[model samples]
Target: MEIDIKKHLTFPVFLICFLLIISLIFIFPALKMIVLGAILAYLIKPIAFKIQSKLKYSSVSIIIAMITVIIPLIVLVGYISYELYSVVSTIITSGSILDINQFISQCINYLHINVNPNELSQSVTSSFETIISYVMNYSVSIVSKFANLSLDLFILVCSVFYFVRDGDKCLKFIKSFIPDDSINFFDKTIEDIKNVLRSIFYGHFLTAIIIGIFGCIGYSILGYPFGAFLGVLTGILQLIPIFGPWPIYWTLFFIDVISGNYPRAVVVLLFGFFLSGVDMYIRPALSSHYADIHPLILLVGFLAGPLVYGIVGFIAGPLILGITYTVLDSYRKEYLMGDE
Candidate 1:
């Protein structure tokens, strides 16, 4: 029996797609949180399974796993927030103009610059105050949206729990929709996606952690105030492709030069170079074992993701691009070049 060309399938397919679009529209607001939850769940699954082996209750195991994983993250964020607030508050209220003037005077003596120290100091102080004030106001606005943030968090938690527990089922459900002939392609694509995930997670994130730890140690040893914060900033910069740790180190070096601590400045600059060199070796060594994703793909993802999805884009953007690349590559290999 020949199936009707447009009688049975077209309307149903159209209706399904229409409904899907509607569903997506409804969920769009919380989409990023949900996506983040799924990504986090992927990371948490192995831990949850190990816990489940002992507890024998999936829900209990997942909750325990989440707590262990999430608590440290929450603490870190809280610490960063507190430190930022304290720093900003101090800089704003401490009448930094005198300090700026002194620094500018030192610059004049050291570099033989003929510029007006007072005027430059006033300009710099004004710019810092304006930026700090804007940041404080933004923070206040975020706090004002606490209720919406709480709802999003609630949804994220639920998503992670469900994804961790029922992830296999979800995979199976998705697999069932694939045609038999395309199953191999689907499977290969999925494996490649996994490799991409491992590449990004281990290669980028772990590298950041190692760099951050070294930064904390090196900066503290170098006697920089807020060494821990600088280290954290260094680690975060390590995640960006071109930025790396140079900004922090260069700023420190300049500060030292202005303050007539040339030796310490040189030492910090060298230490910064070491951190950058270590990244060159460490990132490739960790990521290459899983997948050798192109730097451009990741770079674009990192740069453009935040614009589209806010902060979560940092995670999702690279991932989506990497997965898309893998899928296309898989298709080419499995179908286009299969005979050859």
Candidate 2:
């Protein structure tokens, strides 16, 4: 009477998997954008729902929410890009670099180092020129591929809209595939994944924002040029596992030291130390309520993600890894430990 259930299901499951593989192959090029959109949608869903409570129209709420959130992000990115270009171009063209070179020479002499200052200056100039040139070329390539970029952006927007609106439906549909026995595991895994996301967002990203703000205020008070930009860079560097605001403040400190500004140097160094030290408290305080993710997971994700998924991979990599970890842990708890 059982009628060989496993035998009958095998062909159907195979057929479904085959179709999925084919579909994935076709959408491989736009996969990153699609993933990015889904991630954004997940983050934006609450905002959209808040708006929907007022508007009573899901689509309109989502649109307005997207605009409000996405516009500021776009503007911030554009401003950073423009400022970076301006700084690089100015450095490449201006005589200010010579002053920096002179500073380097003075530092070397003060240290009683026998290295050739002219050779070192030439090397620094050459390295900067090469890096700037490469970045400029890369920027040009991105502009040249406007059509492709537009297509990706279009796909991203569409994906976010649909995912935000239908995400619950999608989750239900997925749940339908889970066996009754494993449903608890699936639910637990999803909860863990959500916790992971919250942990990363609050622990890492929020900390970065706070540190960046402090950097901006401190550097400006110290009379540094491009203080805001340095702060932004500090924030970004804070996202990486091993690196923090030390690089920015240390460099500034050394620059001040070479320029004979000891007071500013000491102040900036102390400020930088504060920025670094505060992260220890802030990250744990924010994330401890959620999942505890290992630093290695994030480090690998951040480092290797861009290679596979481009810039969007930065977000996707850690997320995917964190989710994977949660799923594995859930499986162990539900199956392995349960059996034990």
Candidate 3:
């Protein structure tokens, strides 16, 4: 009886089975966090590397860089939280329902629309009471969320440190198994990934910082309450493409109008328009220079991110698009252009 090993197992079949088992093993417990950490590490690796070059140790450099990034973020969040609490307390204590109602009535009058102030004031007061109640109820939930977020952030920071330190070793170990002929292709793919991450970071972050700074300055100049907080809020809103900062400015404008601060409001409104326009131009230019991806692709990714990944999705969205573009470009260059 001639026993044929080929009948029991083929090389390609065995390899596929092994890969499937390995993939399942690795992708189950911490896949999402791993993916998030990897993306974050990729974006920050350049900074880590720069620090490492100076300090001569990846681990130490990463720790320092992580602290540098984390501390400022913590301070920012703390400041914002404090400001939010102050605003909430002021709103609750002042009982400014009447002022708001009077402002609304004046607006209606200016627009030549007749309305009943007594009825409107009563309705407004009711609504304000409901809002306060809702806020009180929501406070616990928000606190719980922050607790969970803090835990997640701890994990994320630890993961990023390890990733920055061992990422290259991990890549090389994995790539070693690939056929020698395909090594160049794998290397190019990794390069594309790095480029995409850098592009996404450069594009979104720098623009957000600029907008936030300008917004804070503008609000302070106009003597808006909680100007810094609102400015930061404006920056966060700027992540949304096309119409991010408009609502913040518009609300402030309306508030000023009701307070009989028309000149200040008008000036703010104009400044807002200028800032918004500058963002429209600056964001795309910065993104294009870094990623070289299509504007429409970035725009779509910006819209799609929050829908897909919640808040983190916004960053992930453009990143995915950038990676896709880079990979396709690489493939075209290698397969199609070379053939031509």
lDDT of candidate model 2 versus the reference = 0.88
- Any idea how many clashes model 1 has? 0
Residue range 120-229, candidate 2, lDDT tens digits: 99998899889979988998999999999999999999999999999889999999989998898888987987888888888888899999888888888888988888
Ranking by TM-score: 2, 1, 3
Evaluate residue 290 in candidate 2 and report its C-alpha lDDT on the 0 to 100 scale.
90
In terms of lDDT, model 3 sits at 0.80
Error of 1 at 254 (Å): 1.4
Tens-place lDDT per residue, model 1, 167-247, is 889999999989999898888987998898899999999999999999999999999988998999899899988798899
TM-score of 2: 0.94
Tally clashing residue pairs in candidate 3: 0
Looking at model 1, the pairs that clash are none
Runs of candidate 1 with Cα error greater than 4 angstroms are: 1-11, 89-95
Per-model lDDT: 0.90, 0.88, 0.80
Worst 10 residues of 2 by lDDT: 1-10
Better of 1 and 3 by lDDT: 1
Candidate 1: worst 10 consecutive residues by lDDT? Answer: 1-10
Better model by TM-score, 1 or 2?
Answer: 2
